[model samples]
Target: MNDAGPSSSHPRCDQIAVIGAGAWGTALAAAAARAGRNVRLYARRRQTADEINTTRRNDAYLGPLALPDEITAVTAMDDAVRGADAVLLVVPSSAIRETARDLENCVPRNVPVVICAKGVEPGSGLLLCDVVAEEMPDQTIAVLSGPTFADEVAADMPTSVCIASSPVPGEPVGEGTAAQLALALSAGSFRAYVSDDPVGVEIGGAMKNVIAIACGISRGAGFRSNMTAALITRGLAEMTMLATALGGRAETVAGLSGLGDLTLTCSSEQSRNLRFGLQLGAGTSRQEAFGGAPVIVEGVRNAVSVTDLARKHGLSLPICEAVRAIVHDHADIGTTLGDLWAQPLEFESNAHDTTFRHPDANMARERIEELIG
Candidate 1:
């Protein structure tokens, strides 16, 4: 069977409500405006909302640019999403459930909830979509995930993502609002692939941040390309195990949301998540590494969340746990790296466990260090 799915040729919608005002949310708002929708980008902070409407730029995050006349900014949730056809929740994973619960009565019944956020609820092992279902049981839900960097996507760089929605309630994967939302979001440079497995897509998006942090450490430690490659491979193993235990398809992790994003976030200093870890390796304190400005480094919080989730499920996410310990518990970075390097070898590694770290990761350490400076 052909896997790319049918082409997207339909006209885009008239309005979209994008929650949050971070870089990714701002970029998505820009994308939606460009998609011919009268976009309303919401920010929890009134000051940010005022900035977008008055200055025409998300100076705090997206830098300077004229948000299309079709795009407006607002801080009121009811006003922003009440009449919108679809709502994109681009807030952090930690805020997903609370945000959805708050919006439960504000948005229309049929309006789709596009879960632009990624990550499993750390201790609950719940994907963002799952959390939404529990909170907003009747609302249509979809997942948008893949190798998307907010800056690149905001700039309209070539990118792709997986859209998983229940096409039909009783039917199997790939049968839902997920693909339809993707079809509507598609443009010349931004492409969305349809996936039947929301669990796999969400898992890939979450676990990748942990691997990215690990790669950052590898780079800082002067590890070789072979070493990064080995870590990537092993990281993949851990991700697959976590996803499988959580009930996601293994092959799905091999796709764009999985290996694709892992490679992108880990190798490039452009990735905020990886950048955070690189800063830590170079001796920046946790607070100093993040330091007041806004950046969507999912790894920053995911380190703790993932660690908590693993413990709840009785699963071993050693890499993510190590990442959490180093970042939150103030575990020695050198000791954590040493522990990661000392895992017992298993021959005939599980293909599902492949993490996909870039081979030249070690060589990029200097570049990352320079970025931190």
Candidate 2:
């Protein structure tokens, strides 16, 4: 870790180590470099590291986008994190555990590890942060999520994201860590907001991809804007319900990680989940929908995990469940869509008071059961 301690405000993060050299990882390295920090990016392949170092570009991921000289690519994970102030774990959701296990030996106890990948572990239904904690119990942890596109962020386009951190009961990570990380990554065209709700932020990031798939399916099925709008709105309701049930705040779901991410992902074709869903809705087979793309469509895997997570909480997420069926169960898309529309309609709100209120988890579960049953 850097010698600089957390400031009363805006702590210095001069050395940043980013593990994983995928598009998101490379873009984050660019963001950190743009923030005037020395960034060490770790790539699995020697070729990728060599390309970034010699050509000043990660042609495989970012194409011809020029990376700042401040960013250095390394093939070794230990080389990336050694003496770094903070570390960003930018690997895929499925790789979170293995990556964290590998990082456990390299990262310092005091330095915070920011989990940039978004998804629940299909096996354990654990959030990526928890998976990291399980592997690196002594390390401080945080999460970064929001409506971000790797290409746009790499181009230094205006982007805003939320960085959420909360100290575990006996963990070394303090509340100030999240703010410091936000400061470390905030550049001229990139904005980072700090939040204490890591659970909400992570859930929002994961669930949005699944919701975006739902929206894409709607669009690909020839549904108009109204259907997309409905899916987005209802998808948020499902997100809020599951997030709150899992100890996250409903208000957090309304913020950047939740509502903001959901809106951006569902509204754009840049999202891989949406594109995959589009293919499925257009009568492409599941295997064919993937179509040899290198990019992982997180929603395909997350649909199952999210649905299982909801069932574990006794909550029903119709949109996510429908997606899970179509993507994994080999269910007919048209029939699944029809079944979703056939569900019983109920009040959108549980409160009748003067002030508006989102449904609590219990009320949400009850309402969902009524609709589904």
Clashes of each: 11, 0
lDDT of 1 by residue, 1-373 (tens): 8464533443234679999888889988887776677888888898898888888788878787667667788888888896787899999898999999999998877788889887878667678898999999888888888888787777788988888775566543333566556756787688888877888888889889988987786676565577678667777877777788777888988889888888888888888877887777777777777675665677877777776776777877777887888878898766666555444444446554445444555435445344434
Ten residues in sequence with the least summed lDDT for candidate 1: 4-13
Q: Pick the candidate with the highest lDDT.
A: 2
Candidate 1 whole-model C-alpha lDDT, 0 to 1: 0.78
Candidate 1 positional error at 245, Å: 1.6
| Model 1 CA deviation exceeding 4 Å by range | 1-12, 167-175, 290-296, 351-373
Instruction: Find the 10 residues in a row with the least total lDDT in model 2.
Output: 350-359
Best by TM-score: 2
TM per prediction: 0.84, 0.90
lDDT of 1 at 168: 68
